[model samples]
Target: MPAAPLSILHVVRQFLPNRGGLEDFVANLAREQARLGHRVRVLTLDRLFSAPEMRLPARETLEGIDIERIPFFGSHRYPVAPSVFRHLGDADLVHVHAIDFFFDAFALARPIHRRPMVATTHGGFFHTNAHSRLKKLWFDGPTRMSVRAYEAIVACSDSDARLFQAIAPGTITVIQNGVDLDKFAGAAAPEPRRALLTIGRFARNKRLDRLLATMQALNAEGPDWRLRIVGVPSDITAAALTAEIDRMGLSGAVTLHTGLDAPAVRALIGQSSLFVSASEYEGFGIALIEALSAGLVPVAHPNDAFAWLKERHPLITLADFADADAAAGAIRGAYDRLARGEVTRGEDLSDYRWSGVAARYIAVYKAALAEAGHGVAATAA
Candidate 1:
């Protein structure tokens, strides 16, 4: 007959009520696994550094999956919770989300309770600021060490797979993040007024300054376009972004939205004509995919993560990351084409839905378990 259910443990830095692409991915994956008759649980830090006010329960069941939050103590930015090791023996399989985090290192260092261990390298080690020698040394060292600890490593994009291969060099699988297509269901109708949308936290790596400059150049062309940014801002970057907007006299043209739920974000995208991003890097552009599903033409900086996508979707317009003026020109050109009705919607993204994504991960999980000599029959216990 039928194989039994497998017990899976997912480890991440934070969980629901803490908004981000990674958190969403983990939550969705766990929900799908539970729906497929597998026992799934999420383990994360109890405290959220960025949004301390939005505290979550230490133990709770969310969307049919169990979540356990371990109390942590340290600097708000990098809290450490050694107690996760005690719960390591509770699952048949362990999947850690990011390698750069403290919990990943702790999980990798300790015994895995004789279970198959897998790690999904969301961005790999490339997100670190190479300019800081100490930071580079600290992250890079642990990253390489952690890479060797997993039986299989999942990369969200081909670009990320290459980065992980450079370190550990084996059993890396490329499984792009999934998008809930139904949530963004709508026709590709451009708004009467030109509106560009981008979403992410205000981090230096996101390069929001470049996005502002691009908006400045676009506004100078006399079209009077509007740029909508949705994200929580860091203190320093928020001040810098606001000052730059006023200095460029774009206070009326640009809007910053914070604390938007998923439905609100989809509604914002549905109302926009174009989705734009100036991020220097991305493991997999989850927001971009969501925008594409919503039929918004994408205008983004060139990055290795999206190289495969650029080849498949001609509607995507990529601008050189080094030049803001050229990037702005590209965005304006795309907008002009949209205005002229040259392009209406993005390519069909039915393949990247959550059900298919969950199935792919299940296959990878089975392969990892089989390779470790724990066949499906054995894991069913």
Candidate 2:
């Protein structure tokens, strides 16, 4: 029997212009599945702030995947969208992005669609230290309800899977986020730029403040290294961080680069000696994967995913976040080792490539459909 062609649907807040690991994964996987002959479509929120003039009508096609963006009212915190439920009825399977933001909206809309859904927790909202009760209430209440609605759950790391299970227990799959190897290859000769780079949104959980403190402490010790921070910027917070950087006299030593494309980021990684991430918690360190592919030794806090890989690959040097001085020393040591070629990069990164990641998603998609009692036969796309 020929395999059934899946009419898969992916729901998220945004797809293009704003690029995060989950968004990249969905977009890449959608394209690959489309190439494999499955009909895949993406439903997203057309947030005004991100794309003010984005007149994405009710329907459009992007790279063989159908793209639909409904205007949703909420930042990454509490989403309120009425139209999302109406759209869910049209797919054989639904793949949701981010649990905390879209969970309530999806839960409310689930009965209308009656389709089997799976969620990918993209981190940030759940793990961050709560400053207000409302944030906790919003997360805890909606997460419990959302888990019941989902037929299955997936996380980018084993730790993430555990976090997901805290809400709903089941067979949670660990599909690590992947990178485009072709986009990041070793330059002809990696020049000794002796620079450190960190990439991600300037969110509190990212613990960039700690990293800056580490850099300042390192400067005091001896190694005069430059630190480059890159990502999208929030104006008010950027001003505050800039003021602090100026106050610390780190304006010359630390450079903040914003809104860089993937190619640009890879080029920057190629020039840098080491990539440092002090994220208190991350679902999966896609930035580290990118850095590793570009020949930048990764220096991270003792994250579960980092520790899990540290046993096998010597490329990553894990450090304790509480000891800023020790973290700084580890960064310096890794930098020196990378400079002298004493720490050679090892590990087969092919499994984390987009193609491999897409194949894994295909396996999960098949499993979800199967569990939902949808019979899918093997057929060439």
**Which consecutive 10 residues in model 2 have the weakest lDDT in total?**
47-56
Please give the lDDT score at residue 326 for candidate 1: 93
TM-score of each: 0.90, 0.88
For each candidate, the alpha-carbon lDDT, in order, equals 0.76, 0.72
The regions of model 1 sitting more than 4 angstroms off are: 53-55, 75-78, 102-108, 128-140, 187-192, 234-240, 377-381
**Count of steric clashes across candidates, in order:** 0, 4
Cα TM-score of candidate 1: 0.90
Candidate 1 clashing pairs, residues 3+ apart or interchain: none
Tens-digit lDDT track of model 1 for 1-381: 116787889998877666677888999999877777788889998877665556678888866668888887776445677787777655878888876454355546646456677888888546536556865575567666766666788989888887777766776888988877776766334553478998887777678878888888887778478888987664235667778888888899898877788778777776688888888878788877877878888888877766667787788999974676898889878888987878867577877889889888888888888877888632211
Best by TM-score: 1
Every candidate's CA RMSD: 2.9, 3.1
lDDT of 2 at 269: 74
